[model samples]
Target: MLLIIVGTACGAPDTTAAEGTPETLETFTTTADALTVQNCSPLPTSSVLASGDDGAGSVANNTRDDRLDTRWSALGKGVWIDYDLGSVQSLSGAAIAWHQGNTRVNTFTLYVSTDGVNYTQVYTGKSSGTTTAAETYTFATRTARRLRITVYGNTLNDWASIAEARVCGAPATGSSVVWRGDFETGNISQWTSTQMVSADRLQVISSPVRSGKYALKATVRQGDDPINSSGNRNELVKMTREAVGSEYYYRWSTMFASDFPSVKTWQLFTQWHHEGSSGSPPLEFYVYGEEIRLNIGGDPGTLVWKAPLVRGQWQDFILHVKWSPEASVGFVELYHNGQLVLPKRNIATMFPGMLNYLKVGLYRSDTVTQVGVVYHDGWIMARTLADVL
Candidate 1:
């Protein structure tokens, strides 16, 4: 959800009425627009790990209260506050208003983590030290769950303070495991949007789960065109829109039902669809008769990898790709159930000038007579293999 943070000495601005959920950015506001801004949105923020607080007025909530007069102040150096985005996200930067920004500079470092155990430092610098107004700090885009700001005292003394702050989300490119569509929320709320005929087509179930407390049971019968699209599909989407030069690792598990249609046609379970929407996706994971296949390019794309399909058994996959339109620069790698099924192979991962987004569920040629069912869970996208593992 986008939130507008007005940098006036007054208070926060009146945001648009789209405060329904806390993720869809345009639903609120932005930071680059200096006059109106937000404390901790574009990415939702909730304190996860924090040092002791100074007092009641100086609580951690003050950092996001939309008021410059109130601050989250604490004594001594090395004090910090961490925010959990509820789910992994592609974070780009941070906007912070120091406790006494106009008077003193606060030395601080920015760190991020996936599981909240191991942290990686992303940015380190001092606040503007000139204005109590919020300052924006940019860094290389990264994928993670939590953001922590550690302060090492300001210019005045060993006192750490933050009037307001926020971690910004990069809706496009990222390196680490930035998101999960594992049905962890007991629903499909984690995804950017959906293309389902009905909620019943894509359901979250507790039993028959591969990991976590739930799994998605996607069902599709013939002629189920939820969005009145060309093909029959019931899918949940993650709008990655990964740019050229971007690389990422993805992990997920899927199981086809024993009664899944075995027609000698394409039944796509997952795909990185190009934005052009006119032809086959650049990359796709599908079932062709009794075999599972991974294809790259379009139409009659090159089949990079394939294996015999096994029904009623969880199939785990870790896919690594460098998203480039050039064959020499882009590549794809795959590991199935902990085995190196496909080594890194250079190829064009995207159509030139076109972006890609994720769709996972059951999409297939609608001519088949039998119903199709598939279970999916534990979907994660990261920059490194270790992060998804």
Candidate 2:
């Protein structure tokens, strides 16, 4: 009877017979780790074991009993642990126990996952304050294999402890999300605009099409001015999100005024910045047309120009930027409609860090007011600078 009870209380760790006992679970060392994401490296690999009442512990077989770190307060009877779904997996259920001796933890939330790529809260409940801190809760669904337990701030202790993680589920069901847009309605989202300083009359059209593209019209207008000063000169559509420590390649298209005359200097701007928490100057990239040239990292250079402007015509353009440690320059190619036009080299240098925003739109600096009427259409697509080349 004693042996059967003991067996029921402690379940064996999951592992392949050929793999032998793997390493134990280790504490996640960084704050960025608390968020759900995949392919994270530079993490410590040793499992964390509880200190015997002294709050001191050492590394052992982490695979049998793993530990996760939580930013919650380290106060009374609370529980805190993180689950790494290994690769992206479909997670649906979880079971956890709050150390009963510590009375600080009174609430718990169970999170579910799919693709280990993202997680969503699935269950929540209050601790009775009397039950064995070592209690378990079962979930009805069976879709997730990665589970996590988060304790609300405890009154007695700020932290929580986990005795086990029983993940039961299958792998995620599909490919990655191909595309998405969070429309603020009549506003531009997921797009960067490029117009220079002193430029005006930019507007992000919200109605009529309801789900429409941003464009320039003889009389229609859509634009927003950024609160930053560097952008004071040229009006532009900028990407709200940014890349870090890597190069990026994205493409957008525009329609020049059918009436645009040859030799007219106009700029279509999309810029990124490397910023500090307190906010500071950033390395910038500026693209314009006098035959498609660029200003990178504040250094001015010209690639080449093939297609001039045909009145009332639409053209597609590609901007490729590389910023890895090996190479530190940005490259850009301008295409007419679909054909490659002039391609430039070492157009600009990237800053040491990533910029906070990506911008786009049309302007001509001292002459922005006149060219504010150019039409633009297309989506802005981007990936890590390393992925594209």
Candidate 3:
């Protein structure tokens, strides 16, 4: 059964209609319209090089040569190829064509850099193990001059080979910021918290912020009071302003405490809950040990994606969603630490006659006996990808 922790008071009259109502439905658009403007393919002036050349015919240059007959090959694990874009440029995505593309799945990590010496990991995951065709991977837009691909291993062999590699994106045009909650005001006056007891469930802390002097801290301890007939939670809900058919891009940073519990029970950090009822949220971002999961609510429900939940460090997220109940209209695209982990996927984002609202904090099952803490900062919402990227 889905045990949800409601943050509001029990029988709290639906205040959404009394407060600000949701916006009206708007036109539906795809992410391609924004991303295609940047050209996410390999640049003509870009230079390609790699470690451990295979000598026969496969070389680093082969991957960029645009010929399927040519391939870049390296022996053993931990092989990598570097792409120098000739100058710093905005990058939105990358595409790779494996030599034996359909044969075996490959594990790899994509890194970006401006100075070539210092690098940041943007994406890490396994490929679909498809052959012959180029598989495209996308992420939030970032400015960089160098791109690196590190291959750890593959499903079939230790050899790493690529038929082609391409990068796509255009120069950055800053996105418009519609809302922000950096906690620079020294308090969470900009947000509304749902605290059931006098205990400090939510507070503004001074440290561990991505920027500014303050960040929102949520603490959920054993014996903490419950709310709205749900389990103990310390959550902040952004006032309801979303309606069906409206699209939004949200960006935020989150960090799990060092002592964060690893219970098998659900522990929600963030979710887009329907405004109609106190039940499973339409979209949930929760944790299970180091694994972060995204659950889409439905008759049977659906698990869309899961990634490593890196603790101790702040992880950035950019989410683009078009809210709707119809599978053809509603969609979700998730970027983790700038990497496009979940591409635009069609899903039911809302229930019939229901709008959704944003909530962020810590809410876990009663089975969890240990205290839970999570830090949040740099919250923003915008209308376009450029705004949140």
Candidate 4:
């Protein structure tokens, strides 16, 4: 009974077994995860131009520079700071980490605009006078290119000061976010473990980050294997241990090094490996020669999507999957570089009763002699497309 119960719990950690244990009446599966705080990475802004500033160091541009030590301060009640998203985008709110926020409340009004000249008021509120952390203020979703926040001095003084600010994006569809493996925690502590030759195999770097302050730089050399897997790898494992019938939307970004080897073989940067030890992962995103391909099924897998690989530039991907053994019930949808590249396709995503876990980094053929490096960022697993978006 104990062995059966353990095996039935999402296939356990056994991969050599031919079939996974079936779910019993007592077996429980989690379908959804906790909802996020609507704290989407601050929408990217092209340029920040403010109406005024207080001094040389407390300049208008400091608010969006991703730094809290710096601030944008101006004297007066109606002073404002504005931002241009570079292009029109779906906006839902604003997040502000106010200067001296722990001691005072700042009254503010949020506005949005498409042409920068015609602005529409979206929200008017007061900052919570308790913490200096970024506070997200949500409102009706709107499409705009510019965002302005006018502050009416805090309770303590007539100075409008903000340490950092960001425009939050509206969910394009859903909102139930499950987990985030993004390197926002300053390290790889969010992951379950690592499959690397050494500690330098996976480094959390702050520069060249897609969003927030940090990203993972995975480096793989020939014969590098910490888990003794088939291929050489330096991968970060995220043990989601997703169950059958579970659905998730995963959003992430990857950038290949400019000198990444272009050998005529498979080089996987992202994959969802099954519990078993051999064969290909049921679902994987790999670079074959000079092309990026998304494959479903194990050995001799079906190539569902493929594109010419571009190096030195970030590639954004959103993968929506229904975890099921039945081909008719499980499916995969992909959004690449902000466009729907692959529509939902009915297919088996899990192998029999086998469950799946996430692995990110560089995993490739062991025969290749050249070293490979890849940057991964913004790994978010959500129940809704909007949450990942």
Candidate 5:
């Protein structure tokens, strides 16, 4: 049975709407879009914070109110609020009110704004790891008062409570903020999350680990594949953000623990589903549904590897995909580390011209029931094919 899981467990995409559920961003209708009030508050004067159940004090009414389509965790330290800035504020610093006792293990980020339409990040936390943890940074005073806090809890059920959040300082001289994701310091601005398991199954890890310097890792135990998207004991990864175009480059290095059995069907896949389309079909490159398609027995584009990917070692992947006016005439090139494993100029084919996003993670189901983990890092860039190559 499908448990309500938590708050309005988002039903799959309703393409009928302008933007799918995941892309349905909330726009602020008041001044309080500037504050994030949680667990403790009378609701700020000008904030978008709303009161929601954190799985306690209420029965069927228990729910988590997070902006992103997915919840941070089923464990419940995950309560958040987000709002679109109608106009950027001259944000300088913030005053956070904590209801629960202070904690020293939760991390948060602060994003900036200008037009209140797009966001740019300003400050990130390096130390204060609690809801009571107040931090100030030198962002040269920007005109972005809007923010989104993605709380990463270090302690499992130790929830972080926020009474109020405030932005201080006047707008920066001439700086106009466009886009931002709270408190992201480094490459976190490019980060995204996806929940591939059906809600009926138990998926405790709301966030994956960043392996290597910037690797996106996927770890699973022996009986991890509850939904069996790929059959066998497997795990799947899908994009959290959507992107479509003809001139983008994505590169990342990967390493997998060799638990794949010799007789199991293992393959890497990139599934893309358009915004308003319906079907169980997925756009794939290496493996198309139940068949192998890559660099092995068939044409390079549709061949499957006789030998499985090397395990216990790191492998670099450099992908350059370019769009052609002919819709289905695009090109895809894959490079292993520095060496070209899947040659350039190869014509790999998949789905309807436009794409919502790309899934760049591991998809495997070994013959033997065992554990599996894939680690990745390095640069994740989305730029012109020329800039990437």
Candidate 6:
């Protein structure tokens, strides 16, 4: 009997799958007006200095000298490296660690400087050549004292090594995280999913995580099929960035499955969707029978908030929002577990020109069959709320 309709747009729509196209909205900007540095530190040593190296465990301080069997190599094509950090400092992100980096792929470019000769590029990608582990890379926090790395060749030879090199940032006061996914390097390669059809839905579990060691299991059965065939998905990850009009501060941690299945049609476990064409999802959180609702959509949809789904522990969430489709500049707040349960509230999260993108796992309705399981953990995305509460 699935009918909780608020403003319409819910259910029915699977004309044989395939629909995704929308996307193309851009316009982000908001470093919160920059310049905040309230006591930053971290950059004690990495005074590296290279343009050549290839001797004694591969020199250049073996990439910060942490030793994963040591390395720094460098040989042809543009190769460079620097690190200094004696002052300006206020950056955010960089983890590196690639000696064989799982055997290949590695193009790079990241720069920042306060004087090591005036640089400033910030980042450029490529590196999942997974061999010695490490990997992490985040950006958009800026402020620097010199940290360069420019490779430009890899997929095998021309060699650029680098076995360890971290940098992370803090001490800049007003918060700004912008993406995090605490799988702690056990790997989910960060995350992105169009509803991956099975590798067991999505995984990276170590023991149920709330902090670290890894956690992000999804799993949804009942025929599990609907990557676009309209609803009945197995969700998995989905956050390849996209949020407009700024103001974010999400956080995460969920858990369920103590038999979890009090279905009534519609199960969504997190969403923000909207990029247009086909509705419902201006925000959602879902599950109706055993409570735990939120929805939002527009033109009549609203369910505001709800709770009471207990099952098996771990909940936590933060969500701040500000986005906008204008209802006097959108709003929404919520805490749960840190308790502020839905405070600000104004609505209109988006649907004009569209923007908003995020997704978690296990969407339902297709006549519920059962077999679901959740368990996510520390997925951040900040810009304050003290960088994801």
Highest TM-score model number: 1
Residue-level lDDT tens digits of model 6 in 1-389: 11122222433222222223322223422222111111222234436788987765588776653445667887886788887756775776666777878888889988888888788888888898865656767677788877788888798787888776756564347556756876787867676654656777778889878887898788777767644445566665554334233466788988887888986556778877764545566778877677887767532357788888987898998988766555555688989899998898887676544455677877766566777888888888866787676
Which candidate should be chosen as best, given lDDT against the real structure? Answer: 4
Residue-level lDDT tens digits of model 2 in 1-389: 00001111011111121213322212212322111111211111122222222234312122113222321223344344455544344434443333442454457777755444476777788655553322445555545434556566444554454432334332224422212222234344443443432333455553222124444332212232333322123344443333222234555455555544343332433444333222211233223334444333322122234343444555555555443111222444444455555454543333332234554443222323433355444444444322221
User: What is the full ranking by TM-score, best candidate first?
Assistant: 1, 4, 3, 2, 5, 6
Per-residue lDDT tens digits for candidate 1, residues 180-291, read 8888898889888878888899999998999989999999999987765544778888888664446789999999998989877778899987666355678999988799
**Tens-place lDDT digits, model 5, residues 1-389:** 11111211111221232212232212212222122222221111234542243554321111122111212222243444443334554555444543332555445555665544465766655334454422333455565546554444444344544443444444324432222211123333343444334332212222232233233445544444444332222222333222121234566555555563332234443333332233212233332223323431111123422224566676555566542212233456666557665555534222232233444444443322554455545545443433334
Model 6 residue 33 lDDT?
18
User: What TM-score would every model get versus the actual structure?
Assistant: 0.58, 0.41, 0.55, 0.56, 0.39, 0.31
lDDT for predicted candidate 4 compared with the true structure:
0.78
Give the worst 10-residue stretch by lDDT in candidate 5: 59-68
Better-scoring candidate (lDDT), 1 or 5? 1
Can you write out model 4's per-residue Cα lDDT over 242-279, one digit (the tens) per residue?
64445779999999999999977778898887765455
Lowest lDDT 10-residue stretch of candidate 6? 30-39
Model 6: how far is 134 from its true place, Å? 15
lDDT of each: 0.75, 0.37, 0.71, 0.78, 0.37, 0.67
Q: Where is model 3 more than 4 Å wrong at Cα? A: 1-175, 226-228, 298-300
* lDDT preference between candidates 3 and 4, better one: 4
Off by over 4 Å in 2: 1-186, 189-200, 204-241, 245-249, 259-266, 276-289, 301-311, 320-336, 340-349, 367-371, 382-389
Q: Give the lDDT of residue 98 in candidate 2.
A: 38
Q: What is the lDDT of residue 285 in candidate 4?
A: 88
